[model samples]
Target chain A: MKNLLTSFLLIFSLSITASAQQHDHEQHDGHQHSDHDGHDHIQEADPALKVPNAGGAHIDGDNHHQTDGHTHAGDHGAHHEPNACGIVTHHEFDPGALAFHHISDQNVYNVGPWKFPLPCILKTHGSKKIEFFSSGKFNADYHMTGTNAYNGYVLYEGIVRRVVGDFPDGLIDIGHNALGVEQEEVDGKARDVVYLCHNGNKLRCDNKSTLDGGLFGGGITSFTDFSITKNVLSMIFMVFLMSWLFLTIAKRYREREGKAPSGVQGLFEPIIVFIQDEVAKPFIGHKWEKFLPFLLTIFFFILGLNLFGQIPFLGGSNVTGSLSVTMVLAIIAFLVTNLNGNKHYWEHIFWMPGVPAWVKTILTPVEFLGVFIKPLTLMLRLFANITAGHMVMVIFVSLIFVFSKNGTSVLGGYGTSIASGLLTVFMMAIELLVAFIQAFVFTILTASYIGAAVEEHHHAEEHH
Target chain B: MGGSVAALGMGLAVIGAGIGIGMIGSRAMEAIARQPEAVGDIRANMILTAALIEGAALIAIVMAFLVA
Candidate 1:
């Protein structure tokens, strides 16, 4: 314990010293008005200039100028200044921006610097003007406005909206003031300007001009987006994986007849047997074969997807975290439970025998209500549990970014990261257990629902 | 303002659920202690009861989310 304590202390102080160096470097840049950030983008396009930031004329455009009062070119950063998604952002690792980007559905999948647009499919309500194209065509960040158009629809975040304004209404003083957007003179025309928040919400213009927020307006646009979002993609991937695994296992059973279980068969046999014996046999009874397939499929599917959610490399396309997915799963379970309800099951619910006539009146409505309640509860339980786990994990990881970010001291960032990292790991460890236990519980409960539906209570306290 | 009220509602739902599940567990243990032979059946019943309690609490939580 003493050695362990010393090592931890060593790690702690080392991080503090490292962050201190970063702090000094940041301070030097801050004094220079953070001109490096502006030039960094320019360097990407053209790196011929040795002194990338020396081009004083670069401030002419709407590149939300970061130039200082020290430079004669105009302190444009003062007027166009944004608070970086309503929070002071010191760097690109703004947790608020990163958090929502991870949470919400986007039309593009970004892995490091290489970004590829997911295919966006939208159809007109009645006109039937089907538009299918790569979401990258709007140039990733640019909104289809005025002269620029992408198949007559403007993409905002991921919502396809119709652009109707001809640039005049946005420029008018009445509309501009109403929406709290400020205007600037550009090319002999007054233009309303608002900066995009990290998650792509249009906020009042300031120097925090993120490219995500530029498109926010236009006309009578109606289109249904059937886009293949991240969760959908993850679900599709799971379906393919499960199908392949089961099919190969089915083939192996035929090839290795009467032999002891080995390889993939040995791997899955125990879980399959456990579900059949413990979960299916007792609750589902003699007809356990009917529901075993579904129970096994969902058990592995949910288990696989939950594990996928924990993987950082998957880009946070948490399939089960979304409520719609859980709702659909619950609905399927509900149908199977109710549709397969034996005659005796409905008899007990509708006109319960052994109960008094007056008691039946009160019990009947309650029993009826329970039919809907069971499925509703299943939906909520799965959705809430999975969503809560994800939110907790994200919040824990974001603590590192929040502390070390601009305005918040780097030492604080390092300190919080160490503390939060420990907590995050603890939560992650619990998540492993939760991932399995919840799946088991969900499966067992589903089995119980079917069991209750098919149960004949007449042989109570009697031998089999 | 709305968020805090929703949080309060969720807290109440959880507390009530905790009490209910505790009762279910305690009663189940009592039943098991008396009839150890039927432990499998008893365990299944306990889980089902606990799931029902959780289900009820989750309903309230969803309502609170909508309100907030």
Candidate 2:
């Protein structure tokens, strides 16, 4: 009954984590940016740079000076500066130049407001007609109309700009500027200007620049993305998977009592018993009882996280992929391993069984280094492996559409696309297996380390 | 690049450890299958041997990153 209750709670907890409502694949795919309601395109406002192509309404001319329609020898002989998007042209002597306009003369091509969702646009004149550009989501295609020239992204509705002057009238302004759009001139070449945009909304230049902010305050905090719904579900799914096996075994235990184990018990009992006998017994030795719970918790928790890494949406987030989170877990292992270490362990590390005093001093530092290095390696191992796996899967999946640039090449595109999908699925399946292996590895290692510290030196003497 | 290289080494390290561990498991299972009455003794020895192997594998896993 106790085991059954634990299994039930595990399933319930995982269900809460794996709840379909939370996995919102749309949000995970970065489609949330398409839902943006604000007008943030600064390039759409500039009339001179964003002239509709004479050939076709759909064909957008490149905004740079190299384009056919717009020509500028040096400064275009005007004090008017262009927006970052090259959509709006702001003049210095013109009315509202100081009031409605927010362009700064310094760093003439640089756009400010550094963040999005807030209605603001900052622009400045630059040496290059195309001042700032990046393939990130916030920046639009400066070369194509309703499409990204660089990334070939179709400009969805949410990416539309807010115009100030009437179309085909006086000066036209793009991008939402509640405080009136601002700008500045940059000293560097066209591409030299640092482009800013939100990771989620590439069209909105809202990412914190070097002048803005950092991704996280510290390494430890970076792992909290796991608290998201997708991660929770993946972890819970793994726990459910393991719990089912546990329950199957427990039922057999009840039925067979002292008789030979059958079915699920045969598969699982050995592993559980193995951990107890090999890892716990030798490490904790006489004092194993006190630390078993934590060891078990770490084992299960890591196993769940590793399993979570195999799930599609959750794996992409890189929860266990972050070095910080892994570091903390490794630190926990380190603490538990050392705190439970007996006198024999410390003496062996700092002093020695039979080594000379001079040799002992040299060995002590190496031993101390091992303590720090052990946890560090643990963090690196988990983070690197899982993050790489996720990255490869994302790239493989993306290649399907990315390589299909030709509108007519249906056969090649379809074949490669299907192949990529199959490969992605295969990798995901492998990832699931890896998740368990990594968790077991971490748990077993922790046990062994603790066991090492607690093992009797007399045993080593006898062996030698 | 450094990060990518670190990850590659990590994957290799884990794969190596998994293979080594699998061998121990196979041998232990083989022993138990042959002598059914010695299951308990075999189980205990298997665990101890697995732990020793795990320690070595873990150390190698850590060494995999030293090149980085």
Candidate 3:
């Protein structure tokens, strides 16, 4: 009866998400058509404003002219032309960009079409004072471009970016269609530079610096974001959920004592026992008990986050898929492995009793490199697998848009939706397997590395 | 142009990984058939080996992305 109830609940939730996704697509289609109509209306109204091709230089020149005209016309008549600058032109649907955006971390928790704002904590480069406010202060539109700038910061695509030049304090109406992107050369490399238009002036915007150090085209900028973003919120929620669940199961175990596990305990026992028996005991030998807790924690933590990310329309928080998260996990594993390394392990890496001095010279450097490479591989493996899974799923869904030519063809949209839906379901199932496999692989590899570090030197005697 | 070349490199890396994993799977299957009782152990080892190969391919793919 309980199993039936659970299955029914799963089906009900799945249906809800499916319908919500359909509605979202319809709304998006409407938005695209409306924007196209607005663009047509603007072009028809003023023939002089129409350019044969809206290139970068042409747009800039036109924008400057419009801003000069706005100043001469005064503030009252400025409301007559909302998109006077005409920056927000119709762009083709880019699946790659969309996939990246979906997987990337954001300051807002997006559920369906509704965006819930999170608190924003930011610090400027030279300022000692940290600014605190809700992201809702930006009054972000459907496209996540803020209509108002609060304290010189504007929300662009659900992220808070600081205006480059000096601006007034407090809420200032920047109006819609203010944000624009252009390619600019920085350090001999061309990169996208975001600019904001407000009050007849265009201002550059700065993105927060990333620790990747330009490897991913991210480096130092004007401000640093210390906000509790969507990924951070998801992690906090998962931590609480896992704690409550384990506490209840632990309490059950204490009460039942030697009796067979039931309910949630039964569901978890096999998985925990599998890790203990198959992973820990086999890899770590008799000292497995000492490392069982660490192994179990990572296994369950990663597994939980992986499955949590798979839930449709639940913000799709790609926690484990993020490089930063996996890097930290790998760092922890590296620290634990090396810290617990006995004299024998160090000797094997640095000297090697059985090998000759010439071989040692070559092997020593390679062995040293291997130590870092192990953890690096662990980080990359988890990040790549999860990210690729999420990207593929996004692209599969994007196929509907691709075939329909951005909602221009109803027949194509309906035809592709069925195929795309099936593909998404197939991918989801594979991703589910990948979630478990990846978590297990991470744990087992860590255990094996630990096992090698702590293994006894009985084999040395035989070699000697 | 760089993107297309990077994609070609990524495909080459996948080819190498695919071959490596396929060999591991076939060998593991043969071993499991001969010694049915050790299927569990063989499967675990197979997956571990496949993951290591996948790690190499992942590095190549990431390098490709960086190049692009």
**Each prediction's DockQ against the real complex:** 0.40, 0.10, 0.68
Q: What is the interface RMSD of each candidate, in Å?
A: 9.4, 8.5, 1.5
Ranking by lDDT: 3, 1, 2
Query: Which is the winner by TM-score between candidate 1 and candidate 2?
Result: 1
Please say which candidate is ahead in DockQ: 1 or 3.
Answer: 3
What is the model-wide C-alpha lDDT for candidate 2? 0.49
Q: Calculate each model's fnat, 2 decimals.
A: 0.64, 0.05, 0.73
**TM-scores of the models, in the order given:** 0.70, 0.48, 0.85
Candidate 1 i-RMS (Å)?
9.4
What's the true lDDT of residue A181 in model 1? 29
lDDT for position A112 in model 1 = 39
Interface RMSD of 2: 8.5
> Which candidate do you rate higher for lDDT, 1 or 2?
1
The residue-level lDDT of candidate 2 at A36 comes to 28
Instruction: List clashing residue pairs in candidate 1.
Output: A80-A206, A80-A207, A81-A206, A81-A207, A82-A206, A82-A207, A82-A208, A164-A219, A196-A213, A404-A413
